[model samples]
Structure formats: C-alpha cells, structure tokens
Target: MSFTVNARKITLSLLIGSSSLMLFACGSSGSDSSAPAPVAPPAPPPATPPSSGASDTNELIKVNQLGFYPASQKIAIVPDNGATEFSVLNSDGVSVLDGELSQANTWDMDGRSVRMADFSALSTSGTYTIEVDGVSASNPFSISSDVYSDAHDTVLKAYYFNRASTALDAQYAGDWQRPTAHPDTQVLVHASAASEQRPEGFVLSSPKGWYDAGDYNKYIVNSGISTYTLLAAYENYSDFYQTRSLNIPESDNALPDIIDEILWNLTWMQTMQDPNDGGVYHKLTTLNFEGAVMPHEATAQRYVVQKSTSAALNFAAVSAQASRIFSSIDSLSALSSELQSAALSAWQWAQQNPDVPYIQPSDVFTGRYDDTNFNDEFSWAAVELFLLTEDTQFLDQYLSLNVPATTPSWPQVGTLGMLSLLNNGKELLSEAQYANVQDKVLGFANQILAEQGNAYQVGMTRSDLIWGSNSNGLNKAIVLLHAAQHTSGDAKPYVDAAVNFVDYVLGRNPTDYSYVTGLGSKPPLDIHHRQSYADNVAAPVPGFVAGGAQPGQQDNCSYPSSQPARSYLDDWCSYSTNEITINWNAPMVYMLAAMESAN
Candidate 1:
C-alpha cells in the first residue's frame, strides 16, 4: 500500500508453529553475528519447493506458507466450488494424507465462499501441497519442529534495518547497509513547541528513534505503543529473547538484543520532552513528506512541533514502563532512575495542561497523529506511574476512572494499562481490584478469541480489517496469548486461536500474499516503505509486516477487489494497506516471541 506517508492519519487502525513462530517460516536463513555479510541477505527460502511431478500450483488454495506446528491446527482454505475430499501431496505428487473438506461458507468480510480442508490429523514433517479434487493444488509448505525460527529472526531484524542516526555496517546490515542519516543533532523547536526556555527555531539534538512508518518522520504517540509492546514482549518472554540475536552491531552486548534495540528509541523518546516544562513534542519531522530516497540523501529542515496532553502522557507511560523494566539491570539503574523522574515530570505537565492536543501548523505539512480524547492516555500513563513508583495515588487515579478495557492502538491504549495491571497487579491491588482488572482483560481476550468462528478460523472479524489490518490481527493474538498465560485452564484454545491468526497473516487470508515481506510465499514486494523503495535493493527489508487489506483505499490506489479482505494493493501507491510501521512490527515481534514460548 504505497501512498504518501503523511496520509498515515487515514487509518485509525502469523504463524507457523514450530518451536517458535510456527506462523513464520523458521530456519537459519541468514548469517549470525559471527559470520560475514552475504552479497545479499539470503532470500527467505521459497515457501514452496517446486512440484516437479506436474500439478498446477494454485494461488487460491491458501495455507500458512511456513506450514504448521506438528500439533497445531492445520486447516487450509479452498475455494468453495464443490470440493469434497482434499489430498495433501508431497513434493513428488504422492498423497501423504487425505481429509474431507467442510462445506462452502461465505465470509461476510469479502463475500468470498471458501471451505476448510482439515489436516490437523497429519503430523508428519515434510514439504507438501494440499490438492482439492476440483478446486486446485496449494503452495508448498513444510511441517516441522522449529519451522518458523528464521522468519521470527528476520522480522525482528527489521527494526535493526530501520534504525536512524547510524550507518548500517556491512557486517550486520549486509547489502542493505547505508550511510548515517537524520543524526537529529540539529533539530529545530517549532513555534508550536516553543516555551519560555526554548523559542521557535531552538536547536535540539533528538536522535535515534526508528522511523515511525514508511515515512522518515518519528512520532511520540506511535512510538509509545511500539516501545511498550516490545518491552512487554521482553518481560513476558525474556528466555526467548536472551539468546535470539538479529546480528545487529550490539548483538554481543550484555543486555538482551531486544533491550538494545528498544534503548535506541527510548533514548530518543527521552529527548522529546522539554527539560524546562516536562511537556513533550508531538513529533519530529520535515516540513513535508520526503520523496522516496535513501535516509542519507534526504536534506530538509527537521523540527519538533506541538506539545500535547497525548504526547506527554504517552511519554510518561512508556518512560515509566522502561524505568521499572530496566531498574533490575545494574548497568542501567541510573538511566532507570532518570527515566522514572522524567515520567513523573511528564505526568505533572499533563496534569497541568490536560487538554493540549496537537495542531498541525499552517506552514508545516506532515503526518499528524491528532487525537481529541485523552482518557485512554491518562489511564495508561497513570497505571504505569502507579506500577513504577508503587504509589497508590497513581493507582487511585487509574482506578477512579473505571475505563473500559479495549484492544490497543496508538490512539487507544487503556487496554495496555489493563494488561499491565493483569500482568503485575495481583501483588499490589486488593483482591477485588485484581479480579476487576482480570475480568476486563480476560473478557477482551475472550472477545477476540471468539472471532475464530469465522470461516477463515482466524480471530479477526470484518471490523478488524482496518487501515493496518495486519497489526489488528496480531494485536488480537497478543490479547489471546495474554489470556492463555493468565489463565489456569486449558490454554490450547487460546494458543490455537493465536496460531490461527498468525497463519492468516503468513498466507491463509483472502490474498495469498504473506503480509510479511521476504518471509513467506508471494509477499508484498513493493511495500510502501521509503527505505525499501530508495535503497536500490531489489527486495524490501525482510520481516516488516505490511498493513493488510481494507476497503478504505485512503491512498487513492487501485485495488484487486473492493472487498475489505481483498482490498490490498502491493505497490507503493497503496499506503493505506501496504505501509509498514513500528507499531505494526512490534506486535509481530511480541506475538512471535510469545508463540515460541507457548510450548
């Protein structure tokens, strides 16, 4: 989905199950930190090995291209046109397993009729295609333990590729390496963010956050959710990330690689605050969207503009979470304390300036993450502060609001606060308070899990297919997964639902393209990312999740179909459906790590 990155406001918006990231195609697809860069990052192994024995490979028969975990649910969607028995064919065209198909059913999201080929009974590890008697043969997919390892790593490495202010050394960046860009040491304080201490045009050195999306700009509202999601991932599954290296420059550091990556952005986030007032800038960007060019080639005046209640609260929430998370590490203890202080300062500024919202200036034109309601932001930030300081006043503020728990997005984050409470509040809250938080969280998770009733068997409804539908899907997985971990009951249903959503993202959805670039079959090659477009490299960076299908073609791009599920355009014009973002990739990273540890 390629459109101008500034159009990001238009949206309000997988898995192979091997040992980890079964929704992703897992394997040793690249050299590790100790190895030399390849002439090109190895093309992810084709999801399907060639079927030499002669049978058309049909694109309509969508399965998880990375395949399924041996024990996970394995249902392939086939066209509803009278297909009864389906055959699972090995690469040699030999039938390895056979199953009866479910009756054709219409999916309201797309009005496309499809049937399910149940093959969960087949546990053999091999690359195979599903052949329906009348419809067609599907893409090749492998079933094996740890089938998604390589894919998991590749997606996480995408962040490393998107890092700003640093030259991507060939040893780690491979052929994708580029010169340093947006050092951010010479940033201007826009008139909107000017204060008594710093006027308009004040030079500030704010550097090192990941580019917010396909755009080169960075937004605090977006980064807050993105950073918090990664921290939650690391907190929930520290064991999974401790040794999983993307081979970035810091892979050998004492801290976990994920922490190193988060720190890069966290440091930048800390700079967005005005040291004088504790108010935070909404975003750092040029006057207009830059052309598709390498980061080093873009030359424009960058400014931090507009202080808002939303931005300040987001800053407070993320910084508080970071402070608590890093306080345990001796090397980061002081940084933790500094972050804690900043969080409190930001919280105070928001209390004093509770209604300040971002207003794009007359001269400046960029992506505006404008929002009106600050309830979710306040609750989230307050809960985080409560957790960080062990101060009941912060907890009291959060609980007094009695905010309804909902799924998370940059614009809606109360659920994240609730998630944290469910995750860490039992020890701190009264039994009634803990149970109330638990009910809200588990209830939302149940709501998402119920979406598995759809014909596709993924926990996504038509409403879920928004601007960044892919992230919506994965965020649902995050909720179901948290439920699975929080409950003492059978975790299989929750895990299965989460796995099914991963499968949908990988290749099981209406569009056979795996939403992730470079990892699964027929991925979106020309994703709406500036770096990938301008890098001169033929392949887009691997592992960045493309914004999936949605009916609102806000980018003015042509579509294969108007159906919400098939409204995806893989070209650069389809920014509404094809752009990649830190927020989108964060859930993917979280879900992948969670899946790896699910077993």
Candidate 2:
C-alpha cells in the first residue's frame, strides 16, 4: 500500500484492473553495431545530507494556496530529489506520523507537488506541518485522525463484520460488482434471513448491477448493482448481530447495525422472486404490484449463477455462522433449502450453457458477459456448489469444460479468474482435472506476461498504460502470486513478474495503497487528462486512449450510464479498509487459506 520513492515514505492508490503497460518507449538501446558501446549514465546526485547546520534551525514557514486548493495543509519533509526512500514527518520536528500518505507514493506526490499530505486525521483533529532539517512549515498545515467520515466509518465497520464472521454480504459484494464478465449470473442471488441467521452457504440473487425488490416470485427484478451490495451487507449485519443476545459494544455497534440491513435485504430479495420460477429478479424498473409480472423472455436479463446466487449463498453462510453463536436453526432451514435449490438450478443452467456469450434472455448472466470475472464465477460457483451438494458430477462437468486460454486485457479481474482457477479448481477437481484447469489458466497468465515486455517490472497498465489510464495490473500480480503459491510449473517466473509489476507501480505512485489510477469511463493517461464514462471523448494525447477506439464507449463500471470514476490519488498506505474489506480481503484470505490448506 505504501512505497518509498525519493527517500520518503508515501501512500499509494487503488487500481480497478491490470494494465498492459508499454512503459519505456521502444527506442535505440544505445547499443549500436556501428558505434562503440555507450557508457552507463552517471547515477543521480545523492540527497543533500540533513542540514548539518543545527539540530533545530529556527526557520518559520507559511502556507500559500499558490497552485492548488486546500492550501499546503499537510505537507511533510520528503527526500526532495532522490529515488529509493520515503517517510511522513511532522512540522517543526521530523516526527513521523503513522499515516497512509507516508506509505502511498501516488497521493504523497501529485506530479511534482505533495498536496495529499494536507488532510485532517480521523482520530485526532489538528493542523500540523512537516519540517525538513531545522526549517518548519506553518504548523496549521498538517492534520491527523482515525475516522475519515461518518458514512465511511459505517461502511468500514460493516465490511469488517462480514470479514470476521462468515462473509455475510462479502460474496454478494464480490460477485455483484464483478471486475469482469464471465458466466455465473443466472444463479447468483441475495441472502435470505434463513441463510443469514444459519447459513449453509450462499444464496441466489439476480445479476449484480441491478436493484433488488423484496419479491421472490418475480423472475426478474430491477436493481442498482452497487446499492444492492451495500444494502445486502447492512441488512445481514442487523439480522443476527443486532440482537441483544450478541452483546455488541456501544462504539462497535456499526457491525450489528449492518446486520439489520442484511435482514432487510433478505425480506427484500424474497419479495423480488418470481412466483412462477422461484428465481430472483433484478429491480431497476417500476412495476404495478396489482398486475401480473410475466416473464418477458426478450426483456428479462439472465446471467451466470454465481452473479445471481452468490449473494444468497453468502447469506446462507452468514446464517450458518451466526446460528453457531445465536442458536437459531429451525427458524432458518426452509428458506435456506429454497435458496440452495435456486442456486443449484442456476448452476445446472450454467453447466448446460457453456458457449453462451452474454447474459441473454435465455441465459442467466446479465449485463455484459465479456469480462475477467466470467471464468472466475464459474470456478467459484462450481467449487462451492460441489461442496454443498457433494455432486462429483458437477466437478466432472466443470473440469471437462474447455475454458478458453484467452484473458481480457484487463489484469485486475483477470488475475482473479486465475486465482479462482487455482483455488476452486484444485479444491474440487481431481488431480487430473486440476492439472488440466491449471494448464488453461496458465495460458492466460502467460498472455499477460507476453504483453508486459519491458513493463514486465510494472507489468501492464491496469486499464491502459497511456494517459489517465487506471491500471489493476498490480492487483492481478497479487492474485497471480497467490495462485502460484500452490502447484508447480514455471510459476516462479510468473511470481517474479507479479512482484516486479507491484514494484514498478508502487515505485511510480508510492503513496497510493490501492494502486488504482483512473476515472470516468476508462483509465486516464495522467493526472490532468480527462474522459467520460458514456460517450467516446477525445484523448488529450495523440495515440493515447483506453477501451480502444470502438464506438459507444462503455462506462468504467459494467452498468450502463454509471457515473465516471473519480481519481483520488492519495490511497497507498492508510489501511486496507476499503480494498481489503471488499476485493482484497476475501480473495487474500481465500488464497492464503488455500496455501495453508495445501501445506
């Protein structure tokens, strides 16, 4: 999350997907056959030794909102002009504050300017400045605190609730906002109270990215992808943890309150089910409660089972976990069985429709299906379902399926797919089947390594390497390293590649913990570059554009017409709150578990 760039510690940012980077321009290596070999350039000058003049030189500094807004609020002493060092220091004295900006390099320095270092901490409220040598900037320049905001605080608390317990809403959050398109939409569903209270596994919700109504009989429901995920998490928290029996702490009530939200989600998900098929529905449109909501084959969207059912199954797991503590089982069994059945049906459908491209009227997957998560969904669903049902046949079919060796240019999501293969494939499939799956999965990893070229160090630009492009390549590398943890066969090279990718990304944007860097519909080439999430906008730099030059630019988010992502550069090293809570934590835990299990 944090990096040491130029002799100072700075935070980094999070990335959405991996980048296929072409970092250094392909120019003459200066090894001409006709000319003599060129000598290596002299190393840059070393940093000016800490001013030897005095232990505390009396130098006063003032804030000037010269180039940017918010003024020089939290500027700290950096190594100035050297690579390979970083740290966050205090004003008047070089006291280091254990802050995220000290770790992430990207936010620490905004294109030759260190503006992100100017913010109030969440725990303590004050304005302090950073000092270099004996000179001190205005003390009003620095601020430190533990709490970011009320809303962020609530979100973080709910996230940890899922992490500590059985991933109550985590699965839904993971599958709903899936990084890429893969089959598994048909079976994914939201959690029901039964599942949340005494979960056996996950539930069946409609495809992510849509809203969920409280109706279970309706085949299709209208929903917003992100909101449904948030609502589900909150509802699950309240269902089991909010009760007086749990004795949640006053200050830590955020977790229990979130459980209440999950319970609401269960009731809401049930209400959205189609009475006829017993399938979950997306909730994004207005409906007349009095009339018949028939299944409109062409209008109704279907996606892979995992996208549709993981939320529901996750609820089951939550229920199962909570029941262990609260002693509630008979109350939750029937609904749990129903959710389990729905998820099973969706999985069967996926097995039957391997070649189906998008989430079509006949298919379960909704929205765009051409993404990295597609294969991942299949592997995850198959493994989970196989475990729940003990259906070796399912494992056979999953192993037999010929997943394409191809992976999208996007690295973050693609890397996840690789992890899924590594985790689920080995967990469920037989030795032979696992080997086969590994063969196919390795092809995808190799594909990225091939494109990386010299950028192998940084790997590829997550979304795109050019200007304003957001890249998840570092994340992809993380997943790859995880996958490589088990099994053997040239995995070391892949692991090395992943490490290099992380190093390069962290080196360039040291302050950002998340390593993400793009906004709008696609990745940005630089800080100033801009792009829209909807229409195809002009790329500021020639030959620099992301998502290709295709017509009808897709929103950065999979959902249509979603708001463009904003670039908050300073994210490197605060904590793994958001990233770990959602994308990073589960997968990291799952991967580490697999590694430990293997050992």
Candidate 3:
C-alpha cells in the first residue's frame, strides 16, 4: 500500500487533557544549593561588617573553579559553612559555572567527586563562590590570569589496535609532537592552546608508527545492521564536512553525484547480505605473535563459520542513510530496476518480519552479545523506514512497542539507541503514531525528570546517570526533542537541558586541560588508546595467515607507548582521528549541527 511519509508536515494538535498533568511535571527539584552570584556579577559590596553571627572564618576561597592547570592563576574566597550547597557565579553574576568539589551535588555516582580536569575553550575569568551542602564555604575567589603555558602538550601516548591487521601495537609518535613542516603545527606551537589553533589542512601531524605484531583478536562487524547505518553516517560526514566527493577505485569511475554514491553503497550492502537469513560477514586471516596467520578458521561477528561473507550483511545503516538519498518521484523512480528491486526487497523483508524485527539484542548466534535492549534502536529504524517508504506498518510497530526504562546504569549504546528512536520517530509516523510516541516520549522524559539531581548526570556509554552531560546522549536527546517540538508544542525542558550541557562544554576556559575521570571503567575521557581506532587501516600482519593467535591470546593486541605524528584534523582529537568512521563521528556531527542551530 502506498503511503505518504511526510510526518514532518503532519499537524496534529492534542489538547493533552488536564488529566495528563503527569506529563508536565517532569524533573526533580534536586539538592537545594546556595545560588551563586550572577554570571556577570556586580562589583563586590562595600566591605560589609561581618553579618550577625556569620563567622567569616567559615568561608573558603579559590581562584577559578576550573581551567587548564598551571595556566589559570588561582583566586581566593572566604568560606561560609552556613549554607547547604556551594555555588559559583561569573564576575558579572548570571552564568552558572561548573567544576567544583566538596559542594552539594558534586559527585557522579560511585561517590567520585567531579572536578574540572580540562578546558577545551575559554570564557572570561570570574569571581566564584562555594558551599558544602547548604553551608557557605567560601565568600569570593577571583582568578587573576590564565595559567596554560606555551609548551602545553595535550597529545597522549596510545595504542592503535587494528581489526583487519590482527595485531596490537604502539601508537605513532608524531601524534603529540608537531612536525617542523606542517603549518598548523607551527601555529599550534605559538598558540596558547591546542583548541585555538584551527588550521586549514592536516597541519597537526604526529610521528611514531604503531607496532601491530602482538597476537590478538580484533573487532567483528555486525553485518545485520550497525555497519550499514554507520556507513551512511560515514557517507554524510564525508559529503558534508570533509570532502563532497565519492571515489571508489574498483568502480573505475567516480560517481560525481553523492546521492548516486549513496545508492551504490546501499546496493552493495544488500548484495553482501546472506540470501537465506540476511547475515553479512567480513573475512580476515589469523595472526601470531609475529603477526602471522595460522590459516585455520574465519572469525566474524557472532554468526560466523558460514560458507561466505554474503548472508551476514544487512541494511541497518542504510535505513537511516537511504532517506537522505536525493530523489524526485515523491520517492525517486530514477534508480535502476536492480537497485529498486533490492531496496524494495529489503523493505519487504523488514515488513514481513515485523514480529521478529532486526532487534539488535536478538542475536541467536552469539549469546555473549552486549545489552539485549534493541527496542530503542529498532524504534529509530522504524521511523527511518516509514519516512523512506511511507510505511504505516513500521510506524505502528514502533509506537506500539514500549520503550524500556532508562537509567544511569544503562550502557551508552542502549540509551542512545532508544533515544534516537524517540527523537526521530515523529518525523515519519502517522498522527496516531506521532501522538502515541509523543505520550510515550513524555513518559520517558518524566523518568529523566523524576531522578534529576544537581550531581545526577546520566552516563552515556559508561557508569553514573548524569544527564545532559554526555556528548553522545545529548545529541540523541536534542534530536528527539527537536522532533517533539515539530510534533507536540514546546519541548523546552529537553531543549534547555541539552543547551546547558553544550554551553557547559563551550564556556570552559581555553587552556591545557584533562578529563581523568572517565564515564565508566574505561579510564578518563582523555585516555588515548589510539590502536583501538586503526581497525580499518592495518593490513593483515605479515606473518599471520588465517586463524591468527591462539584462542587465549586473542585480546592481547596492545599498542606501543609513543603516539604517532598527526595532521591538523588528527590533532583535533587524540584517538578518534585514526578511527574516523560513522559510529564515532555521526553522533558528534549531529550534536555539532544541533548546537549550531540552537546557537
């Protein structure tokens, strides 16, 4: 049946009854902390006589709450243990600042006090205040100067593990030290901070090649869905941000039109799928300590040992990417029949298998898969599918499915996967679908509100349920809220929460900084294990043949201690540079775009 997928244009106003009051009351009051002076604080009051009974000695003082260490000069403040929570305000009094410990609501679960370890940007130095849970600890501390030095080096020594290469090794050295020739490197050397040196080309080049000879098993690609979707994101990033060109060598001729290239990629994915159960597989030879393959068995995503790589591939990524492909026929008819046939066949397959949709958690082959929560990602995919094919079946499936309760304990992938579905579903579903999703969305949102505390930020891919702090989770929330705004009325809470997080990131003092406390057990946010990102780059180890290392040594592909030379783009981030694919960057780009829009 033909249906219109322009849910974006569908206008359905729900007079959410007064009985629907529960939806409106989302968000916890959180801990009551002393409010700081405005971000733009007024000139200090005349040295007032110590307030009655308020002991000036109870106050504490510090310069800046957060900044690159050694660069930002410290300030001083008088303590006041009279209040319940600590508060920091800007010099002029207005903007709420971040990164203070021993204050109310400062811990992010696990009782680890949150503090500012790095600053990626800069705002004016300001006055600050603090309190330890309702009792004022400090009066005022003013930061006098920036502390980051000229020789500040943020480059991290890391490993670059490659999946195809079947080995673990050290990272390239140039990643930290700039090359003499690159222009950006020169600018970075002179600039006060790495974030400030925005170069034109690959100026942030690093040296130090990785040693990939260690015996280890690499990551396996999930042919069913994740890969295709990631590919689409990869395609979008390449088309919009980096270079608007498509060059496939084997194709001989480059497709000038990006849409065409997208289609080509989509077609290619389908062709690779298992004809029987629709599984996709990729092959890599085994390796040894010397990086030599033993030529035994082929290892892939869960369902391996298949005859070939065909059946393993699915349309996971393509579903999200396909709608963006250019077309005129309401749904284009310009594509070749083979292409159309494959696309339609896949769509049909998805439709027929609605009860057993490609829920990521449903891996019959591998019992050891990650979180078994696929409803969220599936809901998102349904939205995309509906938008592309105008399929109501998909919409109904999505709206009818219940979104699992999300918590700080959930994995990042799980949270984002579900959030993406909530965020994007409205753009393609029918009014019923839209309303149902909106109500459900509100329910999910209320869950977030009900548990919010100043210190309770939902972790994205790690531990702790910190809210609006996770870059990835923020993107998901922002987009879903955007979709909600387009469907329902103002989703300002979601919008505000998202903007606050972005503002927090953007308002930092631009100086040398660090993030030692990672989200979960993976170390700090700044930890640079470069080798994890080089999966696509490394060729099979020279000595490895088929079945790489012995079973026990599969996970030992560690890298070197030194970092590699990097380009301007390379230096922009520590590890993500070498691993420039969709999974990592798509959410990032989406967040950037969203922030830009809000700005």
Q: TM-score for every candidate vs. truth?
A: 0.90, 0.39, 0.44
Please provide the root mean square deviation of candidate 3 (C-alpha atoms, Å).
18.0
Q: lDDT-based ranking, best first?
A: 1, 2, 3
lDDT of 1 by residue, 160-250 (tens): 8889889999999888889999999999998888887999889999999898888778889989999999999888777777788889898
Best by lDDT: 1
- Name the runs in model 2 displaced over 4 angstroms: 1-92, 95-275, 278-283, 286-335, 348-380, 404-428, 436-478, 484-599
Tens-place lDDT per residue, model 3, 359-475, is 222212111112223454455445455555566876576556555534211122223333434445445545674565455546656544433343323212211111112333434
Task: Kindly give the number of clashing pairs for every candidate.
Answer: 25, 187, 132
Q: For residues 1-599, what per-residue lDDT tens digits would candidate 2 score against the true structure?
A: 22221122222231111122221111111111111121222222232232222323232222211111121122332322222232334444455554433322221112221212323232233334443333333323223221112212322232223211122232433221112221123442322211233232333343222111111112221111122233322222223223322211232443344344334334434444443333333222211211111112112222222223333222222222222222234554565566565556555544554333322232221122122234534544454455455578645544544445432222112233333445434555567766765766666566667655421123453333221222234344544544354435544555545544433332223221222122111222321111111113332211111211111111121221111111222211111011111322122222212221221
Q: What does candidate 2 score on TM?
A: 0.39
Judging by TM-score against the true structure, name the best candidate.
1
Candidate 2 or 1, higher TM-score: 1
